[model samples]
Target: MRTVDLEVVRGLYKKAGAARLKLDIAPRFKPGDRVKARNINPPGHTRLPRYVRGREGVVERDHGVFHLPDARVAGQDDRPQHIYSVRFSAQELWDAEAPSEDSLNIDLWDDYLDSA
Candidate 1:
């Protein structure tokens, strides 16, 4: 592993705290595209919400490319890909508990989703 200079990082954050990377990668899922979150159970760090796993949703918008923490935390190669805001209906996620008129929008990585 390599050491990251804290001061250098801090200097860059003087303007904004945004972690969004400027990459010219093509987005896998576009707005209005139907998608499903992958049902995964890895014994490590992940950003995927447990409740959203195995559930289907629509891509609300693409948030551009960023490093996938799952791979990095596993001490593997970094896979930077597009992250998207996906909108899931309450009925689809919570069944009968949540109101049918309600919905949830979650930011998810490309690796965590599949064409539904």
Candidate 2:
């Protein structure tokens, strides 16, 4: 077993501090745009919640570019995409009897959304 020195560990961390994705393209949907979540069930890891699948929502805000977590987790390419805050009415996601006034906000990447 090799014992790594403290200075080497500190240097490595310093070089990798808070890395963020770099993207030159702009986001697709902005705030107030209507969008729908794609109904997908990949065999491996995914960040999209099952409850929000195939549901419609409005884009609430642009959260900037980020490395897609799903791909990264599966050891695939860390594609940078714009993330947005999507707001969905409780009634739309749950049963018809759910409160219409209530809403749920979820952050989703671009590839998971489509025009509603």
Candidate 3:
């Protein structure tokens, strides 16, 4: 049996860390921008949640560039896109009877959102 070296594993993790930090492109929406999630129901895999689809929210923060998971899963190139934390009120996502104080925050890629 072949034994793996600890240093080799550490190097692999280091490379991954560097890759995650590489934000070469500019972001479309900034913090406080209003955006809506696209109502796309693709037959294939997607990182977007069903509840968030067609919902409108305010951008809370920018998470910088990262690989688009939906495309990556399809054996395509790592097409990095800006990810943002969007805040949605309960009333915006659910029925009007939902608690006014309740809200949801989700991290969404650029492609999933549109200017609201």
Assess each prediction's global lDDT (C-alpha) against the native: 0.92, 0.89, 0.89
Which has the better TM-score: candidate 1, or candidate 2? Answer: 1
Query: Which tens-of-lDDT digit does each residue in 1-116 have in candidate 3?
Result: 55679976776765444545476898989999999999999887798999999999999999888898888888898789899999999999997999998999999999899999
- Once fitted onto the true fold, the runs of candidate 3 whose alpha carbons sit more than 4 angstroms away are 1-6, 10-19
- Model 1 residue runs over 4 Å out of place are 1-13
* Clash pairs detected, candidate 1: none
State the TM-score for model 2.
0.82
Clashes of each: 0, 0, 0
Off by over 4 Å in 2: 1-19
Residue clash pairs of candidate 3: none
In candidate 1, what are the lDDT values of residues 1-116, reduced to their tens digit? Answer: 55679977777768873777887888988999999999998889999979999999999998889999999999998789999999999999988778878999999999999999
Q: Whose lDDT is greatest here?
A: 1
* Per-residue error (Å), model 2, residue 99: 1.9
- C-alpha-based local distance difference test score of model 3: 0.89
Candidate 2, 8-34: lDDT as tens digits: 678776655344566686898999999
